[model samples]
Target chain A: MNGLKNDGISEIIDGKRVIVKKPELLAPAGTLEKLKIAVRYGADAVYIGGQEYGLRSNAGNFTFEEMKEGVAFAKEYGAKVYVTTNIFAHNENIDGLEDYLRGVGEAGVTGIIVADPLIIETCRRVAPNVEVHLSTQQSLSNWRAVKYWKDEGLDRVVLARETTGEEMRLMKEKVDIEIETFIHGAMCIAYSGRCVLSNHMTARDSNRGGCCQSCRWDYNLVEMEDGAEVAITQEGDSPFAMSPKDLRLLQSIPGLIELGIDSLKIEGRMKSIHYVATVVGVYRKVIDAYCADPENFTIQDEWLEELEKCANRPAAPAFFAGTPGADEQLFGVHGKKASHDFTGLVVDYDKATQMVTLQQRNFFRPGDTVEFFGPNLDTFNQIIGTVVDEDGNELDAARHPLQIVRFKVERPVSKDDMMRKGL
Target chain B: MNKPELLVTPGSVNEIKKQIEAGADAFLIGEQRYGLRLAGEFNRQQVKEAVALAHEHGKKIYVAVNAIFHNEIANELDDYVAFVKGAGADAIVFGDPAVVMAVRETAPGFPLHWSPETIATNYYTANYWGKRGAVRAVLARELSMDAVIETKEQADVQIEVQVHGMTCMFQSKRPLLGHYFEYMGKSMEIQKRQGTQNMLLHDAERSNKYPIYEDANGTHIMSPNDMCIIDELQDLVEAGIDSFKIDGVLQTEEYRIETTKLYRKAIDLCVDQPDQYEEEKEGMLEAAEALQQEHRPLDSGFFFKETVY
Candidate 1:
């Protein structure tokens, strides 16, 4: 296998052999490191945010320098980078946005995803070289909205999470444009940009990037009676939490491919590197497997297991099949812990010394069994026999966060490989 | 012409006549099935009456044909647009391109106002939508006063800003309140596709209670504070905003009428004698403050920098 991942599937179109190559696997990258991991693990494209003008204000967004570096890294695997400028702009927020957008274009970003028309117009005026895609925050549920954006020169529109399966099919039939949908990760209980619970309660504008996720917080039902506020419903039976389970669409890969969707996106920008690699890798493998052989290929059990291992929150299918009801609404606060603990990230492998160097992400003790896996290599189980620091002193456990640790390994593991232990 | 046109949301055709008498220059009305988040969903016959009443009074009536159409809704919209236009509606306010197409195809010369709740943030988008056929743009409530003024100054189309109303912070097609009730194993009657007065959501950790209701368009989670921007009317009038909207979604018909009259007095005072705005605003504020529920305090949303963040 090539070190750089092959992004598209092979297929025939218009009676000729045109690899039925789309439903592009788009991943989210919070930092430059995550961008590299996404490209290597098998993303056709990665959407990221710059330092400003994004909904994820708290995410470790890239600066222009990091964005340029990230773009160059993604280019090695023939992957594309699109920066997110998806904030609902306030008056002050508009200051210096044109220049920021121009800088994104200069960094060779393939496109910019925005929800505001102001950003679209500015990009078209000053950064004409960059493509523009509409963010899902616009809550585009119908074909006309899709067609509307297309009329205004947008390349694609990320369909709202509330977009029903029937609506998606109708949109594809009615509009001739690239359609993207969120297939996995956290789902907003409110339609993406249609929400500002964080803004109202915390005074942090969810639209302008400071979303505190107030919907996930508990609420008590009340009503006004006799011109006085009355508490009609108490929070006891089940908490009045508005958070939904994280989205998982492993079962719907073939349907999306058949639908001719241009891109299948995962929604997480503030997630871990372990999450970026694990989720991207699973989706990539499943998409490839289904594309390679449509009829015989079934969702292997291992893929679901792999998905379950990395879920920092409980995952489910939302509003994809039909209008979800009580089953879809999560009325509790607890996010599911990762089934497996990510122990380390492989930094370098020395064949001469037969040792693998890594930066510790989680604690690992001697005799702890770990599995080493990479984008291009088959996963192999390894026992933590002896761990040594960079100064060559033996250690009982790799405890400090991101501390460099080395151990003897006969198999040749490449850089960016991950090591994990089942919790 | 110096003062912005005062637009009011009337609960019915009868209220349209009453509100016009109370000093509204225009009316926003529609059938419950067509308009997404309206206070009153007038039926077809009522819609016809509304158009006639507004026309008879020399006032404007704009129908809300702004649902995000699925194929079924899209297929039905062309006939609906024609019906409203045939009834002599002044303009059609819509957010979706489907409705845009309907208005374009059915009523070629019908005035269009692109009023997507959150997307119309900047002048560029407003100008772009103007090119697509919106004669006027209803700016998002999220915009600050500076942004609003900039949009009014720079955009090709006329601009309308909500001067007084409730702001919907969240909307979803899923019957969130119904499901939230079901999840709690507590059954409560939630009126669908219409306004309900009894339901409110209180943050368990905090002390804000947001009024929430479900409709055909979806569940709308309104902001806890009543967005009362009557105090900002002078700035809007001075900025030359084409229209001022008073959304009466959850308020009483009397509150709607009273508020409309207060804004009428306020706008007239500002447009007539600009120097008296501060003096006149006190009486306006006294009346506006009286209407406020103690629990649901009034704040001028997003106009000031503190709330804009």
Candidate 2:
């Protein structure tokens, strides 16, 4: 059992009977509903933030009041909540820093996530007891940077996304500190989070949490002859180009665990509940399976199939396995299409009657092929054969959006089962 | 009349000696194509050696340490500062405040000059650093002569203006192309091909066409207009600026000697006949035109605030 004793559960490791505390299955939640879904699906921790200061402003982030409710709700489920206030503050904006810090602290949040040194200093001075997780935005690529933050009283350093397992191991060996790495997510074209390109191009600093992703814009090539201008559009596109692949590191879980990385992070803060539930569930299963038998553990193909159903660019191992090249680059074309269109999920599945009822989001018709994604199950896809409406009459399709509907599922489904169409 | 400072960007040691023999006041050692290049093998110690050589010939030398430093190199700041200070160089030109503070703490007595990238738009920020410990502030290339005078009043330190060479239209805070190479898993050697081979897109086009290999993001041309303030020496001196800076970090010894001699002669005329300075303007323009012919279509730049965009 490789699990920590404080948490529940036991598993065998290294041919010895050891208690394996379930590793915290942290998930990204972009909305209130997604937060609830993540909690219900067994997320040990959820990281989120208010719209203004957090790194991903484009995501459906919570407001201050909503964040307060999020914290309270997570506490009820016995899970931790971390709020981001990680924008780089200039001298002028430092005035509001105290209020923001006080607000989050008073709200009973777990910790404050920050990147800038001045903000770190301010947080330490004002809310000394509040835990501070150093954001990856500071680009902690080297051990010296980590040591500096650790000396400054930082609780944990979210290592730069570009760091490899070997690098993480070396860092862990060098310092006695809590290290976190992004196990899954969108990889930045810039070094981890040191990008000022968007800010320079459009006054939307990624460091300040307002990133107008100018890197994603298209550009046309221009040729010159003898200093005389020659417009060349051989590629028939803007000379500006961008890579649009999402990072996936599912196979490297054992490697990460061996590296002694404290936490694994998932990148999307603007994805649906089904996407969150399916991904988290798949990872949770893989982690459990690995702990059961590290040497013989294998990632099931069905989990990879479920992952492919989610909306993503092409999946690549990123800089972890080795440095990526042009072959990995996603040019003008968008990658894979999402197989299932997300409707509301099954909040509760009745076991005895083989009936799975869903809190309908978008309208689902009888002929539409739907897939049920739940924890510990390979996402089962089936065409909607018989739909029982509110009137108990079998209908070809259920048209009303967000309406509750019942359908028969072949497998035994549990509570918090996510349902989607098109799979 | 004081001999005008001869700013030369020598590619080799022989060129440095040649410029010294041609009555140059100072040797400004920088990479030829790029505005300033002191990375890897070419570092502060090498710059110190160049400075030492210039000092041997009774010439002052200014080292350009103006590149943006990533956080990874923060620890190296103190060592580099100590080396420059210990070498007894005239001044260390810097852009980042982290570098500035590191230098101030490491070598408290050394003179630190603000690189133009500091964006000293007004006296507030200028005086902020000047009060801290800077000896000189390089005014932004885009500033009008009038704005320079305005800033001159509030500045506690000596003001240096770019009297010649390329003018950057955008701030140096733009993301470096070198970073683009890192992201794509390519070598920064790609920069030498694109950067040196052609004038950057933003720069004025010359007849020398070369292939512009786009970085992961895109390609940008160099600054089009080379600044010429030779005819305005009297107005500049009257405006109370202490030093005139030339931007070429890459120029032939002949170019440096001729330009320096002409400017030195103009400055003498201005001192000899301050009231009749207009009489010498034609001769100065002729000399400036001769240099401009070698590098055509010189821009007066933001000195008089002509339409740029």
Candidate 3:
């Protein structure tokens, strides 16, 4: 094991010992159910937001009670929960912040992620017991920022998404605090939430979690000439010049582990439970496999295939490899469709009748062939033999969102196993 | 009531004294190294001379070091901060927390102003900065009058809101303009003619056009309408705001001089005739209407309606 110390557990694989350094796999959770799914799928930690002050304001954000339940549920799986209060505070935003901070602290959350300096100071004072992780919104791209935050006594600093793996290694060499970076998710065209295009176009505040995604709008490159306007036409459909491809850094896991990054973050708080489970499960497998043996580490094509099946735009290795250019820019399109549609989620399973109660997400019919997968189970395809509502009335299709519906299957599925319509 | 101070951005070093003579109470300027606006950056010598000129007229000057900094140049920043502090700058306007922390460490008692690129929409954030040693918080340009008033009422820190000027709606750290030029195969040395500082960029799907400019801090796309709230000086005064900013670094000298003088007149009238300020407000509004550029649009941005969405 080159540079791999024995701090990791040794396991016998093919009658040989392998040492593994397992970093925490942190995932994003938009709701309490997603939080449960993420934890069950082997996420060591999950970052979420409360009703107020989270950047994903429109998300089914947790209330104080929900946050308490989430913390307790995650604690059962030995995972941590971090809450976001990362909005840049204006003058009036401070009045009830202390109370919220105190409540979150008392709720036994692992940490609080904040962007504003004053917010960090307030958090330290009001919720001294809770750890404070610097939000990526701070756009901390330098070692000095990391050192400055560490010297100020912050527990961890989530490095900006734009940091290269080389810079990360250098930063880790300089600072002794926990380092977290976005390993996967939708990348912001603007510098990590430092955008106001949404605010000026619509009344939605992007910093306050109301991103209108103005960057993804179809745009034209135009120039002014002689008091007249002319279009800079290209050989394509309308150019989405500002839209960056979603980031997926599955290939760089060994390098990131060698640098000893404290946590690897996945960024999808506003996604469905199926998306969370699929993404977190994939990352967990890859990291664990890599940790078991570094010298023989190999990038698996199956992991990428599984990720492509979830709700995502086309994925590209972002700035981690280098400063992304036209290759990383999405052109002529706003978003790409996933390979499969998330149909439903397993809520309850009656082994005797082979009936599974599910919360329908997308439209699916009685004869649709769907695949079911969870934390401990391999994906298995099952034909939906019958579909009925809560009152046992037969339905042609499960059309509504979050509607309670039951379907007959051949085998029992665990709670939280995601169901997706096969292509 | 005290007259609200007028802060102006001069187009050039020579324009500084003239803007002060036109009744500019203070100056918010920047150097070429770390300032937000690339076109308005003053050399170090000009910065020192400008400070002397402002102080000669009994005015305050704040230097803007508000660019989002990267780690490669982190050491250079400490020297830059020390240089600005030693060069007699009254205060430094910073947006990055790391830079603010550096300043706090370098000059523990220096007057530091927090200018987050994102709007500080509420009072709690300002109070948070106030307790952390920030003397002033410039309210975000998108704030409605009600939010500004609430910020001033609730946050104990000094509040500064842009009352008149172009508002930067989008800022990015990527070298988008350079990249565009490269993509277009255009020469990098294209000489930009005067009066062409504002570049208009539009989307194919949307008819609205935005003004884009780039510098050391990266690209800044501005709102279409120039914010003109000189007519609402009394409302701002009543909201406990005393500092009004006018961004004219990209505007013509004539426009800068006229706008500064118009706000100066409006502030004096509001202080002198509080009960009948409406009469003075009409006169100032007429002055502003007369000073408008022929084809340029202007609006009272988020001033009347609540902008919290």
Candidate 4:
């Protein structure tokens, strides 16, 4: 409760008292600020992308300096950092591969997740100190593969999202290496990393991280009569047939923990700091709550509600219980618009003056009521009592984008706490 | 350099003879129980007959058990692998690691073809499997020419490339079509066209129409245009590609025979007249274009251009 660190759960293993091995809560960090927020909020580790070789090319990926700083910050907060080198490397990409690996290794990363064997081989050769975790793009769903990877010196394997809880338990019994599974995020319509739709359609290589998300695109059912497009199935609407609802496994945390899952991963490297704070914070609390009292614990509705505050499509437990049916898919729809607007992000908090400093992301009026919440802190309402600019001059409203603004608060707010007008 | 062998997938016993007559050097046959292609699957007797016929014609026959297996149904695989080997199959073409392990256990000496659907995109992966006892690596469809050339040069084991056919752009074990139909309040018992149920759909924004089909292996969303690399035969051969595969299970028997014949001519010209590749390229293009007719559209697909961002 004092900071990011939490006590591990105790249990009897092999007839002796031992730590029950609390699963690592993994979160995504698109930027350096997000990285800090993830660690502060509850993430035991954060996965991020470097300047090159990593997927999510469009995300605010870390430069070498940023990665070094991110690593140091995570280390200080007792969180591990894993870099993404999950791209399918081409011959043209061979030259820079070694340098990228070495740089990330030197930046204090715990591991690098990769899909290509060539990258794994190179990581073993050039940066042997850095552990290699197989990416889900490999679509490894069986025990033999996990066993093979464990024998092949891979430190961990991120199970494909298609793996069910029962399958996970079987895999756990078969392999000795760590198993990480995605607990939240967008789902791919195609098999994990084998998708060619994005590449053939948009020319962006999904393997190289230029996923245009062609799967989310609205598609009309067309009858090809002699290679000619015939009738459109739907009228005046983009029927998003391939789009899947964002994955939410909050309800399955206790089961995942009971099954001895090593890491519960949150998939969003291109999302915002607000997203990192909100999602990571909620998961952190849930994991901590479960670890405190596993037998008597149950998932709170507020945890799911807190996650919904972040802009995402309708959430579902995809391929978790079993192979999802029609009810699991988000057919004929884009995305469900977020109920709450992301207003601003707290940059600094001063306890002496009882003033919270923040950068405005959306417009907020001085008289509007706002809710303040962050990692490890309870949600509290605060009226915008005295709005001031960077110079501390009183202002009527904070309208400029990323404008530094401060306001007096009743309770002490911490950095990375989000400010929103609506509940 | 060895002349690249023309391997074709014959859907039925009838097409087996026709494909061989059309000059296919090898055949990829599937079984009704475990093969990825449900329609093209042969029964036990038919599989043995096809293997004997292939052997009698001095051609190789590889059996496909390439469907991704779930743990629920995985216990049935060992018996299947043993049956495939006992049936005198030349090799087992597969994608799943569990199946590979089963093949290793049941048919230790049986030649293994690492079906590229497992995403063997680089030479390291190809060689990794080769070291683990795989005889061939069927290269992934997503690789560019440069990557293919690099893999062929560096790979220690044999490598095969799918030269022509419908490329499966997406594959999942989930029943996407059933879900889609139920969601749309439509009946799943729609009539098949000419006894073949080919489902076609497209992105509303793009003009491309993707062909979709489902079987026991789940749904396969094929590329809008069928891949035609007849003109690229010489290039693929020169890149040290050992075997050339022509996908025919989704196609008609006549289409299979015609395409096999077409690729046979192209492969011979490339092998016999190595220096005349450019000169013969135009004629090959014309012949390949003629084979397209009015139904199948063709493209180089991920071979010529780097798949975009």
What would the per-residue lDDT of candidate 3 be over residues B30-131, giving only the tens digit for each residue?
874676763366777788888888888888888888777776656577777887788788888877666766776787777878787465666776776676
Among these predicted structures, which one has the highest lDDT? Answer: 1
lDDT-better candidate, 2 vs 4? 4
Global lDDT scores for all candidate models: 0.82, 0.62, 0.78, 0.80
Alpha carbon deviation, residue B71, candidate 1 (Å): 3.0
**Model 3 off-target regions past 4 Å?**
A1-21, A90-95, A117-126, A226-228, A233-240, A344-370, A380-413, B131-133, B153-156, B177-196, B203-207, B238-240, B272-280, B293-295
For candidate 1, write residues A324-384 as lDDT tens digits: 7677767765587889999999999999998999999999989998988779878788888
Q: What TM-score does the predicted chain A of each candidate obtain versus native chain A?
A: 0.93, 0.87, 0.91, 0.92
DockQ per candidate: 0.60, 0.10, 0.40, 0.58
- Candidate 2 backbone clash number: 22
**Model 4, range B111-164, lDDT digits (tens) per residue?**
888885626677777887787778899987878777888889988989898888
Which pairs of residues clash in candidate 1, taking residues 3 or more apart in a chain or in different chains?
Answer: A10-A19, A11-A18, A11-A19, A11-A20, B193-B215
**Candidate 2: global Cα-lDDT?**
0.62
Candidate 2 regions with alpha-carbon error over 4 angstroms: A1-14, A17-25, A192-194, A200-203, A223-225, A230-240, A348-356, A376-378, A386-396, A399-401, A410-415, B1-45, B53-309
Model 1 global lDDT (CA atoms, 0 to 1): 0.82
> Could you tell me how far off, in angstroms, the CA of residue A98 lies in candidate 4 after the best superposition?
2.2
Task: Indicate whether candidate 1 or candidate 2 has the larger DockQ.
Answer: 1
Which lDDT tens digits does candidate 2 get at residues A209-270? 66666445544434344646554334443232445467788888777665666677787778
